[model samples]
Target: MSDTTQAPAATGSTPASGRPAPRFPLPALIVMACTTFIGIVTETMPAGLLPQIAGGLRVSDGSAGQLVSAYAVGAVLGAIPAVMLTRGARRKPLLCLGLLGFLLANTATALAPDLPVALAVRFVAGAFSGLLWGMLAGYAIRITAPERAGRALAIAMTGIPLALAAGTPLGTWLGTTVGWRWAFAGTALFTAAILAGALIVVPDAPGQHAHTRIPLRKVLRIPGLATILAVVFGWLLAHNLLYTYIAPYLRQEHLDLTPDVALVIFGVAAIGGVWITGTLVDRMLRRLTLASLGLFIVAGVILLAAHGSTPLAILAIILWGLAFGGSATQLQTAAGAATGEHADAAISMVTTAFNLAIFAAGAVGAIIVDGVGAKSLPAVMTILAAVALIGVGFGRRAAFRTGR
Candidate 1:
């Protein structure tokens, strides 16, 4: 764990500084990006398809919603363990296996007879997706230059925003038009295609951690790691609190736009946000973090004060997407900066925090939705956004100390 770890040789030549030599391979990056996109689609597409899934399986909406948590529970229970278990395996095979696993999970969900079976298959499948998520950023960064880690992560992560913007809506339509199961079948097909691409394209680099077990203690001891991760946790938690109920909130509040239209607006804005972060994160990391977190706060307030105005609701969601989407890239970049040499370990921890938040966010959102109502989310988001802002303040100070 003391910086002698081997990087994926297929990435580029290693320098004494331990960063990979600059040799950008755009095609490989694209494959990885596509893989990440499908991974996200598998994780999130269910949110918009809940009603269809419930009707198909003869279950309640609440039970169908558990599909989201089932995946997260898999991530929470399986992501770290998957990475650790596959530590000695070559990078390409591990990733390929993970991708292939998604096809099986989604296909099983598509064919599942009952809710319990769907949840079980989804959990097992989630374990695989979690491995992909937990290891992906590190793999993407490792195969590229160190200074461009942010760019590499940004490109790889573009899939996330795109999934939100396009994948879920398409899944909803597929569920609505054809059948709920087809939506999952569509995901299976998508995952298979990406799996084939990954198998063919990604360089067969030896596993970076083959000789170096992630020193959990060492990573935790890294300066400011905790604060940066807190920002990650709080950011996702805040977003999911309301996002988990976005469709209903929009309908009940009479936002004028259909939920589909709203997601389109939000998705497009999110893509813009991630693009901005990718362009600026490497050059202006701290500044970008503060600004995005601030925008998220303003977005929460916009929702609180929307007062049923169509324009305000749209504006609020746009702002939300811009801030939240960018924040994801910014945070992963910070995680890179925080652990410097221990990128994989640091990213794994970040992934754990991220999915754990996703798991918790839905449950917490459900509580709020059932109790105080979706209207209460704006106030709660403001509070969490404020907390994330403070996390950024303390986190930068923590990351700065690592420079010593």
Candidate 2:
């Protein structure tokens, strides 16, 4: 769908020039990118439409927040099993099946009439989302040149920020203008397009290894794997604690912004951040990771100062978005580097940690918001950001020791 296609190379083959080798067909990359875009959009739409959904379903705002949490929980639980179950499956078929599952789950969300059903559907949607993302990362790496793997991954991940920047706003507008159901209906449509694109473009690619499958436990035992997981867990926990509650916090503060306006601002800032960070990640992975963590801390401080100032708060959020946009990519790269041969398992573990962070953040933010009021949002976020920074310090030490 996007006019981006680089020629594919042989799968799992080393570069002939003793450099990074290209692994998959260019068309397959495009298909995977499209699927990634739809996956992100489906995953994040609920964040933008929380208030409307809460009102429509007659649930507490906290209960409505569970829609986001449920998906994160499902993703945390689903990634490993999916990877293990489909260990040696062809990439194209797995991609197709994952997207198909996502399509069905989103459709279920669109048609659900009750809160429980909606939450359940969101969880299923999340499960599919995890499988799709995990597979995409591994598939991209397997199909691309070693030197180009970072760029390829960046290209694939571009879908996430694009979905956040463009898709979320569109979904929010649709939710406000039509109904929240239409937002999910839109996701289903996009997923269908991605599915079609995959069918038309992706070639049948073989598995990365014929007989070498790393056990999950062995994968987890990589030197810095546990530390990296801790760092990502902390980073995401802090980021989502603020992010998941942002829309509702802004509303409760009686800020002079509508839901659509806020969502647009968030989407734009997030995309800008992702674009900048994506490029940086391809070059200076570790340096950028440290820089992003610092920026996140600064964003939290700025948010604290901009507590009641709408324009200032918007500016702060944009910075926060930029910081967070690079976070997962940075951590994913770190995990891959740490577990050189077990890239698939490393990817799965990182995915799991990320989802768990989302679930933890949402649950914690809800309690904080209910007990402390919206004005306390920045302070809470600031504290979490500080914690993330501390984790980064540990990550830096671990990286230094491991020579990463």
Candidate 3:
């Protein structure tokens, strides 16, 4: 928890505050991102092996689904407390310890005897994940050149899309090739390697103003933060509503691109989106945001209008990845931009909203899909994307007016 490493001075750059930031080591940044990648891959690994797990443990499909949801639940409920409780801890050591716990959790899941035991193991793993995500942005920024914070953050955040893109297919192959338990065991091994990397490469990062507690009131009082939260919440809700049911929707539409293939296309597009936005965001925050949301709107409309068309469906999937792909970069960058020095709490709040939005959208999307129709989900997404666009406008204006 102590500052085990000294902050290194920024090279060739001074921030708007006229202070030099520590120049983060690249390996450290990479290890940080890898930790997240492993955590999420482990968290979502069960989805690819659900039937096997259910059959192996003698549980129903619905109960198996709880294993996946448990992690999201833990993430949503744990973000704030995790961030706050570890507020003063050294970033590297804390992240290392968290990843270690992650290793244990996955090991536990791999060896769990019953559905109830696996669910509990996953929830604990999810809490560790929540802590890692909530702090990652601030940690990235704190150790990077002040002017290049956005890039540093972008690099660190690449884990989310990467895990989403790779986790299922890889886990499926592993689980299918061997057994369901092997997937968790394999992830535990991967996590252990990343943990070693973290210990060796990552420098300790203590908060700049470690003595001052970032009060929730102060974060809430920040101009346009509410709007940022709104955009993140609404945008995620809109995206997940349809995303959770994408395969069924595709079946209903009779698209040729199988769900798995479509996911690959989406994941690749998202990676492209992240790198592109990371480069442009610091320079054109508001414009790029509008553009990002616009892509989602276009994607939704495409799916709604061209449900049965293969080409358009392909386009829709690509667009979905592009817009939603760079989301972490945009949202976390917005948090850093809005909160300035007090970004940890801001990041935590945004992260909590982000986590909760996943479940909310899933539940709501299920209702919409189950009742009206599958295609209706896209219609709802388009509406939500529009709301998010409006929120971006108001949010930027408010932040400017208040000089945030």
Candidate 4:
């Protein structure tokens, strides 16, 4: 975390000793992107298949929701250890191992005959997902030039929102048409593809610092890192509170919409948001963060007002998706910039905070739904969105003072 320990500068076409540090090749970037895509698909596919899974397992819909919550819990717990244990390991092998774990876990889930087994398998899948995402962010940064780091990170991260846009709808369709098991099986296949791609594409560039000597305390003490973590946690909590309930809420309101339709809309809007924001991120990350937060506030308000009207509700959701997608890249970029040399730790902390928010939001949303019904969701989201705006304001002020 010390400026003195900054990564060795890239000399003219080579390191100082004349050996070339590996360049960020397109194939390697593709491999890392696939890894992120697989992890996200595995984590989010269950959201679209929850009803089918619940029916198959002989449980209420709310009970099946626990499967999603359980996965998040696993992610929150797994992130830090995954980074610490694998620190300085080669990127290709780490990615391969992570995808292999995901493949096995999803395969187990696909074959499991009972809800308990399915939940446990999902937990395992989430652990690997957390590891993959945390490592991928740092790996992507190392492969790209400093000026283009934000863009590179966004490209790698496009997997997650893309999964939501395409993978979720595909999983939902497969589940409804064939069976939920097929959805899991398909995820396993995607995992396999990601593993194969990673093994072929990513180069092994070990950090110059002694792998065993990461200064944890120094990393934690970095300026603005802790504040960014707090903002990310709040932002995620607000988003997931509504996200976890979106499909169910629509169904309960008798909107005459299928899970596939909902997912398709959500995914499309999310993908569009991610694509547009990725282009703008390098030029205006801070401004985009503020704008995205403002959009989130508007989306939450619209969600509150349009809950009963099907067309209006759907429109609101698309706006929500756009806001959510844009916010993700901004948060990750902000966290990475704050951590500098310890980007891996920064990413891990953000992943951990993000998942913890998911679990908390899901649990809290369920309680709200059960107690006060869907009508309360908007009020909850509004409060969280307001807090996130406040956090962003504070962040901007702090950055201005520090000339960051």
Best by lDDT: 3
Model 3 scores a C-alpha lDDT of 0.81
List residue ranges in candidate 3 displaced over 4 A: 1-24, 208-211, 398-404
TM-score of each: 0.89, 0.83, 0.92, 0.85
What is the per-residue lDDT of model 4 for residues 1-404, given as tens digits with 9 covering 90 to 100? Answer: 11111344443356556766555566777677677777777777777788899998999888887888778778888888888777778776787788899989989988988989888888887788778878887788787766556667777777777777777777888998999988889888978887777776677666425644566677677777777888888888888887778766776666767656776687778777877776766666666777787888887787677756878778877887788876667787787777666778778888888888877886799899999886677678878888887777787533211222
lDDT tens digits, residue span 237-330, model 1 = 8887777778768766777888778878888999999888877676677777788889989999999899799999889899999988876667
Ranking by lDDT: 3, 1, 4, 2
- As for lDDT, the candidate ahead, 3 or 4, is 3
lDDT of 2 by residue, 325-404 (tens): 76666677677666665666778888888888877886788888889876676777677667766655676544312122
Q: Which stretches of candidate 2 lie over 4 Å from their true place?
A: 1-30, 46-69, 112-120, 208-211, 251-255, 396-404
User: Lowest-lDDT window of 10 residues in candidate 1?
Assistant: 1-10
Model 3: lowest-lDDT 10 consecutive positions: 1-10
**TM-score top scorer:** 3
Tell me how candidate 4 scores on lDDT: 0.75
How big is the positional error of residue 200 in model 1, measured in Å on the Cα after superposition?
2.2
> Candidate 3 clash total?
0
